[model samples]
Every structure is written in C-alpha cells, then in structure tokens.
Target: MENNKNIIPEKSGSKYDLLLKIEDIIKKEYSNTEGIVISKDGEMIYEKYFGESNENQKTHIASVTKSILSILIGIAIDKGFMEDENQKVMDFFKEYDFIDKNEIRDKITIKDLLTMTVPYTFEEYMEPLEDFTRSEDWIRYALESIDGNGEKGKFKYSTMSAHLLSAILTKASGMSAKEFANKYLFKPMDMEEINHNDTKEFSFDTLFGEKIEGWANDPMGISAGGFGLKLSTRDMAKIGELYLNNGEYKGKRIVSEEWIDKTLKENQNGYGYMWYLIYNAPIRMYCALGDGGNMICVIPDLNTVIAMTSSFMMNAKDRIGFVAEYILPALSN
Candidate 1:
C-alpha cells in the first residue's frame, strides 16, 4: 500500500526465491490466506495479495491485537501512565467488588496480564459475545466471574485476563487503549498518513474518523485489548518493524529498549509478555500470532519481519512452521 512499488527488490538469491515460495504455499497449502508481507532492514521486499484482499484492506486481527496491547503497556509504563509491570492490577479497578477475592487475585500483577498468567480459574468461562453487548460493565463481569484459585504465574490463555489489562490501561492512562495507542504507537509510526484522519484527538467512542479504523470496544467503550482489532497487512508490518528496531520506529523512540529486552526473555510457553516465541532452527522467532493464522513474525538475528493474514480460525502453528521449514533454510550461511 501507499505506492510501495518503489521498494527496490533484493538481489536475486536463494532467499529471494524462498520469499517468493511463501505465496505458493499460501495458495496451495493454505487457501484461506489473504496475503503475506515480508520486510528486511526496514524495507518491504515482498508482498502479494490473494483472493479479494489488497495490500491496504483491513480485517479483524483476532489475538494479534494482544501483541499491540503489549506494546502499548510498555509505552504506558515508559510514560508513567502505569507505575511498572509489577503493579497490582486490582489497584486500578478498586471500584469493582470481585466475587472471589483471595490472596492469589490480590497478587495478580500487570506482568501477569502481559504474560497471560493472571490468577483466575475461568479459562473458558467468558459470557457469550452476544451477551457481552447487553452487559453494562465488562470489567465487573470479568472480575465477578473469576474463581481466584488459579496457580499464580502459570500461563493460561485468557481473553478476559487481557480485558482486565485493557481496563487497567484505560484507568491508568485516562483514555481508551485505542486512543492511547493512536497517540503513542500508531500516530508515531505514520498511521496518520496511512489513515489521513489523525489530526484531531479521537474520542474514545470513535477513532480514525469512525471509518473502520479496526478497533472493537466493549459495552463500556474500552477497546478490547485481547481481540477484535483490525489492521491491514501493511500496518502489521509497521508494528513488526518497530520491534525489529527495538521499540524505535523510523528513528523516533516509542518505547524503551529495556521493555523490549524484557519481552525477549521467556516468561512461559516460550512467550515473553504477549509475544510468542517459536523456534525455527537457528532462528528464534518472536511472533504476534493470532487466531485464524494471522501472524507478525520478527526474526531479530535475521533482521526480517514476515506478516500474513488468513481466513481460517485458530490455525497458527502450521503457518509459523512454514516459515521455518522453508524460509529459514534459504538464508545464506
């Protein structure tokens, strides 16, 4: 998108051939793929659209939104909106009376939310999405539904836990996660030009001119940090680029390198914060993996970022392996 044809192609080599092969796999192996975008050293070297999707068309990124929220949490801490990663989450939502408040729940910290290890026993216990729309307070519902008996610091993929992080971001930053992200993360990365409606401060109710800016909110108007964020293939590449540069995008420091460093260390399940780590041979990949095969993979040692979006839901492991199985071996030794 944005007339990116000017991106000079890399030299014709094995890696370039391997880059081209990714599309064939997407088409033959994964028919649901929308597209794949790859960049190296900050320049988009390969991009191809499949089906009806274009380079700029946006779609729901599902759990990939969690990785973006993770970045914003690092920024919130850097800006002092949040005290630190260890801050107790209950401190932010003191207004709510949890149904099963216990020692474990009180010890739930920001880091726990970032790592998906919040001490809650309701793994598959969210009120139905249809029911969420009718509820007056999502955070209250989330807090009340928890059993508070989960093992602390253990990894459990919980969207409600992520929702708590979103609420904390809203309470600490005095704005919705969408507004705070646009102000700090997206706007700085030149999404203003990508969307052309970033001049005015977007109200929490709407952002990017209310024109499908790819954000979903709860009944209480807080952006869902765990899922339902929409971003184009191009926008996803920009986010990977930011992490590739260690929290600095295009020479401007957005979040601290300390935060990036902390994110690289595995917390659980080869996951650091919200980012998942997948080992692909000699390369250790840091990935923002979403339901339905949506992914933004960063190979720090290789200085490469690969992003892909697909229609299938909850199928990311095989897609990630494709990159390792094919792309990683093609690079020169």
Candidate 2:
C-alpha cells in the first residue's frame, strides 16, 4: 500500500543556544536525521544539518508529497482548472471504466481522497507495497481496489489511493503533475531547480538511493501523490511559510488565501487536505509528516514553520517529539 504528537514545557536560555542544544540531541540520538530548519515570523531562526547531508541535497520526503499535492489541488481550484474539492473524483477518470459497479467509487469525491477517508476495502488499504508499486497501472489498480459501500467517511489511508489525486491533476490540467507543479508551485516560491527526466526508473533498489529530478513519475509520467517527492529541507520550510502567509510567496499570490484556510480546516478525522491539523493541543499546529521523520510543519500560535529531512532509516527518532519537547518551549517567549 501507500506510505506514511505531544508537547513539552518551557525552558530558559537564549533561543539560539536552546536550538543548538536541540541540534546536539539530533546528532546523538537521531543520527539519521539529515536536516532541520525553523523559521519564525517569516525569518530563518535556525538551520542545521547532520551526517553527510547539507542544505543543497534534496532527500525523498515520502508521504510529505501528499501535502504538496494537496496544495496543487487547492491551486487547481483557485485557478479554475477545477471547481472545488466537492467535485466528484470520477469527473477526471471518465476514460476508464469501473471494475465493479456495485461499489460507490464514482460517488467518491475529491475531498474524500484528500482526507484519506475514502471507504477503500481492507485489502486495498493493506496491499503489499511491492504488489501495488509493481502493478502495470497504479491508478487503475487503486480504482479497482475501491469497494466503498457506506464506509465513505471513515479514514482509510493508502498510498495507491493518494496517487489517484495525481492522476486527477494530469487529466484536469493536460500537463504532467511535475510540469504543473514546477510551473505553478515551485517556480513561484523560487524552489531549487528540478532536473527533469522522462525516463522510467521504477526499481525499489534505486528508490531511496537515486536523487530524482523534480518529482518521480509512474510509467504514465504522472507524479506520485503519496510519495516520491524530493526537496531540500529549507525548500520544504518554504511550503510551510507559504501556508503560514496564506499561500502567497514574496509579493505575489501563488494560491488563494481561501484555499489555504480551507485546507487547514480539519474534518472529524483531524485531516485538512492531507495536512494533520491539531487544534486541541497547547501548540496548535499542523504538519505534513512522512516516513523516516520527513515533515513540513506550521505552528500558527507561534507564527513559526519547521521542516526536516532524514535518511530512509527505520527507528528514526520522532520529529514531533523534538519539536514539542524542546523546540517549541525553547522558542517560547
């Protein structure tokens, strides 16, 4: 299938010194964590890297790509490529016929997919990653797996399911997801240059090792929605900053403020267009968290944004723990 917090008390010290101590924690404990960037009030407060990683290297962010895709979906609506998230997901999949008419897959809307609440069968949610990734057509396989009866509103997270959003983007925009993202999202934010290649390289052997240009695509050239996005840790913070500033970058508006606001409004599942918006916590924040501790997090109460990247190592220490237990209280006024 597809991939993919607590708070701490206040502490005393210079904010910079406290962050330096946090870096020490990362060095000793979370050895695989590549980098961490923190910005407060649109200013870079701290940025540090560990191991062989540096500011220039772009690491695969796994499910952090889902949050980026959510931004693109909002842009699609903002620019009139699509109307709204309520639009039927089947609107974009007209070319493909349904595998089983008994299922309510067509009734599934874009919001359902965005919130990970699509009523997918247990098998679809738990399908082996190798099996799903090796399929001839990923989007088709995911659609065929949908067996939503009345279970539409319940959370059913799956990577293949999220990839369908990418497919929808391609069909709606007539451009590959990478092309659209590069033109609309990355360029506006002055993101790192994406090295574009159309060649198909779908081997797990090269998945984490190979540094992809721009974003990874399936055989059909559609960008992966749930994973396969590689971005610099600082560039990931730019995304958080963008949302923190209500979807505008620099002086121009990249995405509508309304879309950004709507994207942060959580459903009962605590999800807001692929973002995990935590309203009940002492530090009200939302995060685009991914495997191996990759994340883009926004703390609205503090007017802060944080981004982090780590190697694809199992047993990586928790990014949330670092933020809650040390970073937040360290930065507290």
Candidate 3:
C-alpha cells in the first residue's frame, strides 16, 4: 500500500466545488459509502474518505473480486500456464466422483465459468456458510450442480460457478489463487496481500469467536472467485487503471492486450468475461462491480478510472450516476 497522502494537487474554483458536492451526495444519499477515488490519464485527480475509512484502508469488496479473478485467469493464459479459456472445466477435476460418467456436467468449460453460464440453477449452489463448511469437497459439490438442461449459452450468474474458477486455477497452475495473484498481479502493481489486521473494517465474527480477513475460501482453500475479497479503494483503482492502460502497468505487460480487448468486448447482456459495460450517451464505460455498490470503472474515451467502496447493497446505479452527472461533465476533452 502507498502512503495515504493526497497526491493530486487541489484544483481551484468549480472543480473543487463540484468535488465537495459529490462528497455530499456520497455521505448523504448513498448511506453506505466508505470512500471514492477518481484517476484520469493514470493519475489521481479526486479522492475523498467518508465514515470510518481512509484512502489506504482495505475492506471487503464483495463481487468485485470476480473481476480480479478474471484478471488472474488472463495472466494465467498469458504465462502459458493455461493454454486457452475453452478448456473443459471437468478436465481439471477428473478425480471428482460427482462428475464421473456425467457427460453434461463434463461439457462445462472455462469460458462458461468466465461468462457466468454454468449449467446449475443459481439457487442450488447458494449453500450457506455453515453447510459449505460441513461439505467435505467443494469442487465435487459444485460439479454435481449441472442441472441446466436449457439453452447451453444462457446466462445464469452464479457465485458458486465463479468459485470453481479459483479451484480450477489452483489445479491448472499448481498454486493457490492468492499465490498466483500475488506473484503476477499484486506484486507487479505494488498491492498487498490480505491484510490480517483483526480490527479492520472487513473482519467478521466467527462461530469460534475469532476474526478472519474478509477473504472467504472454499473447503479446498481456494479463494472464492465471485466475492469476499478485501481491497483498499486505491488498490481497486490500480486494477481499473491496468485495464485502461490495456494490460500494461508502468510499461510492464501484466496481461496481453488481446485478453484485455476480449474482456471489454460486448458479450451477452452487455457483459464481457465478468466485466460489465454501459453506454450512456456520450459516455461509455466498462466496470468491475461488486455487491453493495463497490465499483471500479474505466471510461476509455475520457481516459479515466474511478473506484468507490460502499457499505450497502443495491447502490451501484447511484454511484455510477455520480460519474455521469458530475465527474464526466468536469473533464476536459
């Protein structure tokens, strides 16, 4: 983590006034927001903290973790660790008895997981934490959920389906998802690993009266790919900037430009490989969104990246509005 200094020099007049107004909207209407940082042309331009957080503080980022996982998959492909995204998911888990002799389940591929087209009904995999803990094998449990007999490419967003990608990464690369991220993505970008501080905002109470970092792992110890990642707003911004820079950070290619292009390409439902796209008039954006309003947005036309951390669910539209209504209008062409 970098120093919590306000690196961007404050601009005078209307820009400053508009920033104050944006902060007010975050503090009042968006009751769950912790902080937001906006960067343009790869430099911090506007940043502010609210409630009990600071610029460097890390918190649970909910489903934004999926976007990070997708990045890792990209890196895995770039390094030749995994040859292609079309590799069959069942090929990685041949030992699992659940998929044994099951052709339909075996047909699931890495692209399916990336595109959120896992065959299982969404509700079937919504297993509670207690039940998940008691399950002996998470990979087998996830594989057995291939009940979607309808259209093969139908989009069905499933957190459990995303979680399987983490497990597959571990199997394909011989390292945990966290290890792969640290070595490839985090270390190169100068981001830290899971902050182990017990009192941090992302900690949660356990049945044993102990606290664990916001990261939730499956029974197999693979990090959950869909959600449960804790990252500071600044760290999250680096991710957006990395994509905005087309997979290069500081002249180092973290992921291939081709992968970045495919990720931003419009797919089903205006989504592309876990990234969401929006076209609002003159402003078009690609975003990494998590539950509870956490977002890391990239606006290529303006060359801007925005990251926000929020405390409540169902507040993404409002946060995105701040960008459309306030930030974009202030930017110079």
Candidate 4:
C-alpha cells in the first residue's frame, strides 16, 4: 500500500523476466513450495506457489513460531507483565508448588529459556506421554523432567526451553500463550491469518499399524514451545518487517527499539532469543528457521525480507541461500 519503489529494486530488464526465472527455480529446486520474497518497505517483490494455497495448503511453520514467541516476549516486557529476561521463572509460577523446592530450577530465569539453555532434557520425558494435555500436571511434569545436563549459559538447542517460556508467560500474564500473543503481537501487526492449534485429540501416523492420538494437545501446552505454530507466508513477512523497522509498524511502537536491537544482535552460538543470527558476508542477518524448510530472513543492510515455505522435503537453508546469493545480487544490480 505504501510507496514500493524505496523497497523493491529498479527493474533492470523486466519484472516478468525475474518472475519467470524464480518460477523455474521453484519448480526445479523445490518439489512443493509457496514462496514469497518481500522488500523491507513492505512490497511483494516475488512470489511463486507450486501448489494451491487453499485451506489444505497450510504448511507447518515449525520453529518460525519461535520468532513470533520472541516478539510476544517483547510485548510482555513492553506492557510490564515481564520485568526483563533475567526475571526468575519461579516467580511467575508462584502458585504452582511443583517447582518450589529445586534450587537449580529456581535459578532458571526467563533469559535462560529464551536462549535455549534451560538445562532440561525433553526427549527423556516426552516419549512416554500418552496424552500431553490430560496429564493434569504440566508444571510438575516439566520441572521433574529437567535433566540438568549442563550448567547455565552453556549453549544447547532444545524445544523444551521454549515450552518452559510458554508456561512462564501463561503464569505471568494470566492467559494462555496464544491468547497473550493474539492480544499483544498478532492484533497489533494485523496478522489475522495466523492461528495456534492445540494438540488435543490430534493424530499422528506411525510406522507400525498403531495410530497415536492426543500426545498432548500441545505437548508444550502452556509449555509447548519450539514448534506448534501455523502461519501464512504473508503474515511471516510482516514479522520480518516489524523487526527491520525496529519493532514499529504503521507509526505505532509495538516493541522497544532497544529490545529489537539487542534481540537481533548475535549472541552465543549466533543465537539471540529464538531467532538465529546469520553473519553472511556483506551483512549480519537475523532469521527464523523452522523444520521442513520454512524460513523468514531479514537482511537489514540490504533492506530485504525473504519469506519461504516448502514441502516436507527439501533443505530450506540452501534454497534461501540461493536467493540471497544469486537472485538478490541480480535484482539489486
């Protein structure tokens, strides 16, 4: 809707020529995809959808949901619901007695969860859960399930940490993570297409004849972090735009510029909060990476945001790199 010339590069030949080439790449490189690349100023620069983008076209965004959750954390901080990332997780869940005793667990802070260094092992506990939601005691299960494999600040990538943050947010804000996100993050961004699905009564097909149902409406439930997020490609691009603009959209400051700057900066292992910091040659980029090849990359130096979705197969990082390396150079020149 705004002026797109500032964002999209000037046409060297013709826009149709670029679109045709992109279409060919999508067809050859990715078997099934719904890809869209938007300029930082909010213009649709390129798009290609191999399959139909109807109701059945919904693709699981895997961990890109983590970046959304990170933004929600920013909103919570902005609203004074969260003091800071250093705030203790125990303080939020005061009513829950399950985590009251453990000294190490008490020391776990919101920062620890955001950085994925919560010192917990989710795999040890998750395998046996017949029904995640019906467990009736998610907090106790999570606290007890903690493995304490390493000391705090040691980098470890785990889904359980994100799940823990979800629980802490629910306790602190007095609302479900989805509800909190809807109020603070989604509504502000006008991201109406995004929806959170609880895993209650869900089914997963196994290699054997047995069918698994209701593993845990959201195995992370209040804790179901890391994954369990569904979003459209357009909505994903808006998130990148928000970050690129330093957490401002439509002249309203949704998140503090300070928080956005800190979150986008590289941390231990190129991780900051939930987003991955990529130090690619000319620019230092921040990206949200999901399983099965879903990526939302924001290159601040180039003023570019690339949103992509692929099928169950194909490597997302490689495909996204191709755009960054090959297509972007040609388009910019």
Which candidate leads the pack in TM-score? 2
Candidates sorted by TM-score, descending order?
2, 3, 1, 4
lDDT of candidate 2 over 1-333, digit per residue (tens): 110001112433577667767766877777778888888887787777776677887898988989999999889888888888899988887888764674578788898898887766555447556766777788887887777565777887777767999999888889777888888989888996566755376777344445555577777778877888789998999999998999888878999999888888856778888888876656889999988899898998799999999878776777877788888877784
Model 1, 1-333: lDDT tens digits are 222232336567666776666666766777767777888877787877777788767866778889988998999999998789999878987876655547777777889888876655454444354444345776876665555666777676777777888889999989888888889988888873223222122332332122335576776678876776778888888889988998898789999999998987864478888899875356778999887788899998889898887764434456677777776775543
Worst 10 residues of 2 by lDDT: 1-10
Compared with the true structure, all predictions reach lDDT values of: 0.74, 0.80, 0.75, 0.65
Candidate 1 clashing pairs? 214-230, 292-312, 292-314
Query: In order, what is each prediction's RMSD in angstroms?
Result: 4.8, 5.2, 4.1, 5.6
- Determine the C-alpha RMSD for candidate 1 after optimal superposition of all C-alphas: 4.8
For candidate 3, write residues 186-237 as lDDT tens digits: 8899888663322222223321112436466665567766766778999989
lDDT, model 2? 0.80
lDDT order of candidates, best first?
2, 3, 1, 4
* lDDT (C-alpha) at residue 323 in model 2: 82
List runs of model 4 lying over 4 Å from the truth.
Answer: 1-19, 54-58, 95-102, 121-138, 193-198, 205-223, 280-282, 314-317
TM-score computed on alpha carbons, candidate 1: 0.86
Judge candidate 1 against the unseen true structure and give its global Cα lDDT, from 0 to 1: 0.74
Instruction: Supply the TM-score for candidate 3.
Output: 0.87
